[model samples]
Target chain A: MNRLLFALPVLVLLIIGGFFYRGLDLDPSAVPSAMIDRPVPDFALPALHPGKKGLSTADFGGQPKMLNVFASWCGPCRVEHPIIMRLAARADVEVLALSYKDDPQASRAWLAELGDPYRQIGVDRDGRVAIDWGVYGVPETYLVDAGGRIRYRHVGPLTAAVVAEEILPRWQALQQANQ
Target chain B: MPAAKLHAKLAVVVLIFVIGVSGGSPALAVRPDERLSDPALEARARNLSQELRCLVCQNQSIDDSDADLARDLRLVLRERLQAGDDDRAALAYIAARYGDYVLLSPPIKASTLILWTGPGVILLLGFGGIIWVRRRRPVTALPPLSAAEQARIKSLTAADQGPQ
Candidate 1:
């Protein structure tokens, strides 16, 4: 019993040390989104492009799609632009871009310069729509299955490795499940 | 006497310096336009902003953070207040959209039990350790010195006294 009592403190210390060691490997900035597996929030905002109808929650449930929150002012959005462009080129997936807290004119110019890859683009000028989506920062991407439920959320600038390793496999799984 | 008076003067100076620094006006991050005309509603909005975390900043309340998202959250809170939602309703609305992480003080729930109880448990363990140590049996007192040992000690003292 005495031996057990002495071992208890050591065991607790080891457990705490293990937890801290695990925490060291985690990215502190990456907050897990509460919206995963939940339906996208209701929103209808003005379109970024002229003469086109705006994007809405109604556009989401009918197919597997990607909702990318981005801004012209956000530097990481520029870094992830090529990966989004590549995703947009795929015939199977529909990429919807939400311009978050950016000027419409600047977003238009940015899209023109970067080569527009989005199927539909919405301008969230006041960032109200982003708040509804629980977006803390720009350059966040959400993968919405055919049922409009969010399957995955990627919180930072997407690199080629993240695209190939994390996103594509899950997207493929979502696609297969839909079919 | 002079040293004591100098110490008193130094203490007074330190106290004044501390009070001067602490009593200065706090820098508020709330923008002028976000303020409501109604003082009561504005007060409520400010209180709510203090309770909400600025998601962009590490350990900063929305009321104190200058981040754009913090400003947006403050505006949203004000809008909710203007719309006649009660304080709880406004907070719930924000919490629903932003998750429980947005609240500066998380609500007590099943998942948070560890966080709430960890310090108390550690404190109890500390008290338990002290009590156990205090209650432990001390080593038996050493047996009284034998007569031979006493005689050796007396002879050593006598020799030392003689040399002296």
Candidate 2:
């Protein structure tokens, strides 16, 4: 009993240290989106391409799709652009794009250079639409389910690893549940 | 001068500076263009912005941050107020999208009760620990001095007294 009493403080210290150690590995910058499981906030943006139809909440029904929020000026978006292209090519999920706070001309030129993989592009010129979407930064992605509810949101760039790991598992799970 | 003295001087300078600047007009980040036409509406907007976190900066409130998203949030708050939404409705609109994390001081709720009470709980635990340790000391105290040990002590004191 005395030995146990002597070890009690050490045990408490170890537990507290364990919590702090776990905290060190956490990314403080990744603010989890409050919009998850909620319906895509209502928004309609102009077409990034002159003739193509723009994007909106109405565009999200009948299938699960990925909405990539990116800007021409954002560096990480370019890094993730190829992965988006690959995803679009697989034809498993409809990958859409929101051009956040970007100039249309610049966005068009970027798409021409990078090879546009988006099914439809929405232009959020002043970034007001992004506010409703709770976008704190560029290059966020939201995976919306068939029922127009946002299932998951990734705050930073989407990578091939992320697509394979995070996106695929959730996508598969969502598909099974739907069926 | 020694390092400790130098640090003391610097501390005094900082203290004086803080005291000197304590009562000045606060520097608001709200740009003139973002302000509503009506003062009452603008004041309400300002109050709401103070409660909303600048998600980009995370630590600074939207009213105090100069980040682009902070500016956009300020505009959204003003728009809501101009449209005649009450303070509760205005805050709820922003909170709906950004989550409770966006609120600088989130209201106490089922999810937030722990956050609000954690410090106090730790304080109570600390007091309990102190009391337990204090009380346990008596139970685990050194055994009473033996009779032989006491006699040896008495002889030692007698010898010392004689020498003195």
Candidate 3:
């Protein structure tokens, strides 16, 4: 009994140590999105490009697509530009972009310089629309199913590995479900 | 100095340290334009902002964060207030969009019971363990000293007292 009493503190310490050890491997910055499996919030904004129709929540219902929140000033958005371009090229899914809290002229110049990859670009000058979408920061991507429900959310820059492993598989699943 | 006076001085120093550490630094990040004209509504906005977490900063309340997202949240709160939504309604609108994680004080529910009560439960268990250990400890009674040993001890005490 006394021996067990002596061992209790050590056991508790080991349990706490195990939890901390597991926490070390997890990404502290990755906050779980609350928008998953919910309908995309209502928003109507002007187009970033001249002489084009503005994007809205109504635009999403007809197909499975991806909505990317990005800004001209956001470095991580620049990092994921190529991947977004590649995703745009795919026929299975449509890619839409929201220029979050960015100057429309700057956003246009950015797209022109980087190569335009978005099917429709919405200008969120004041970031009010982005707030409705529960955007913490720019460079977040949401996968919307054909029913206009948010299926998955990816925070931070999209890497080639994430595209192949996480995004592609999820997109495929959503596509199959639609079929 | 006397011991009581020294203790009072020490307490005063500690009080000063605490006041210094927790003084009204007003780390408010609310921009001038964000403030409502009506003092009563502005006060409500400030209180509401303090309860909402700044998603970008993660650790800071929107009232205390300079992050763009935090600023956006503050603006939204004010907009909601201006639109005639009450405090609970305004908060609910944000919470529906951002989830419960955005609230500084989470509501009490089955899901959060452990988070709320874990510390208190741990403290009770600690006190209980201390009491249990003390109760279980056997106090051994000392054997009576021999007359010879008592005499020797008395002699040693006398010699030590003489030197003192």
Task: Give the better candidate number (1 or 3) by DockQ.
Answer: 3
lDDT of 1 at B153: 100
DockQ of 2: 0.70
What's the TM for model 2?
0.85
Q: What is the C-alpha RMSD of each candidate to the true structure, in Å?
A: 3.6, 4.8, 4.6
Question: Best candidate per lDDT, number?
Answer: 3
Best by DockQ: 2
TM-score of each: 0.87, 0.85, 0.89
Write the number of the candidate with greater TM-score, choosing between 1 and 3. Answer: 3
CA lDDT, candidate 3, residue A47? 91
Q: Best-fitting candidate, measured by TM-score?
A: 3
Query: Which 10 residues in a row give candidate 1 chain A its minimum summed lDDT?
Result: A28-37
Question: How would you order the candidates by DockQ, starting with the best?
Answer: 2, 3, 1
For residues B34-152, could you state the per-residue lDDT of candidate 3 as single tens digits? 89999999999999999998888888999999998898889999999999999999998999888888899997889999999999999999999889878888678999999999999
Off by over 4 Å in 2: B1-27, B136-164
Q: What is the fnat value (0 to 1) for candidate 1?
A: 0.46
Residue ranges of candidate 1 with Cα displaced over 4 Å: A4-6, B1-23, B136-164
